[model samples]
Target: MTRESGRYKGKRVIQGGRAQVRTVLYMAMMSAMQCNPVFKATFRHLVKAGKPKKVAIIACVRKMVVILNSMLRDGVMWDANTAKN
Candidate 1:
């Protein structure tokens, strides 16, 4: 299976193997929660709701995938604030 990274430069980075890609994606998501302001806020919001940290993190990761998908489909640039809109 081939994973497309979309345009010349986009958020999606396809790791070589399927399993490896999943692992890498999960790690990337974790890093985003720490380094990306939007993701960090979202994660904190989820935590404040009494959600399990693991569950909230997974949800954030899923959101990231969806956002990446939308960007790839629409050929839009990454805008952290635009994601919440």
Candidate 2:
């Protein structure tokens, strides 16, 4: 409750308990890069094509949100290895 009571509740932060959201997003992206073949390949391709690493990370984050939304709406479990838009 305390964490969510602050002015930045439900927002991204670099500090405080509320920072978990950003941390989790970052971790999810990193995890996908490590274990999700499709994401890994996409990220590598992006980087190789001269897209900055940071830009690629942001792309992965956006993709994660879209994938999550699709899976939730469709009532499906995610298969990161084979999942590609």
Candidate 3:
């Protein structure tokens, strides 16, 4: 699958993905915002670095997916310290 990133009127726009997956990611992101310190820090860092709020949230969602995938692949439990790295 191809990922597309662009700007419209100075606003970042990210597109290209399954709608269902996108929905799930967004829901997970919302939960992460409340309960995941790593994700919360990632979002804040991105926004502080000049990224848009939505962009930062998307970044966190991507990070969450990667972390989850690695956890499953390695048959390991979540570790906050390891995830930070």
The models' CA-based lDDT, in order, is 0.83, 0.78, 0.84
Model 1 steric clash pairs = none
Model 3: colliding residue pairs: none
lDDT preference between candidates 1 and 2, better one: 1
Weakest ten-residue segment in model 1 by summed lDDT: 5-14
Candidate 3 per-residue C-alpha lDDT over 1-85 given as tens digits, one digit per residue, 9 for 90 to 100: 4444464255435566688999989988988888988888888889899997887887888888899999999999999999998
User: Could you give candidate 1's per-residue lDDT for residues 1-85 as a string of tens digits?
Assistant: 3456446453333446578667787899889988899889989999999998887887898899999999999999999778874
RMSD of each: 11.4, 7.3, 3.4
Q: Which is superior by TM-score, 1 or 2?
A: 1
Measured with C-alpha atoms, the lDDT of residue 34 in candidate 3 is 81
lDDT of 1 at 16: 63
Each model's total of backbone clashes: 0, 0, 0
User: Which residue ranges in model 3 land beyond 4 Å of their true spot?
Assistant: 1-12
Put down candidate 2 lDDT per residue, 22-43, tens digits, no spaces. Answer: 6798789999899888889889
Of candidate 3, the 10-residue stretch with the lowest lDDT total is: 3-12
Task: Compare candidates 2 and 3 on TM-score and give the better one.
Answer: 3
Structural RMSD, model 2: 7.3
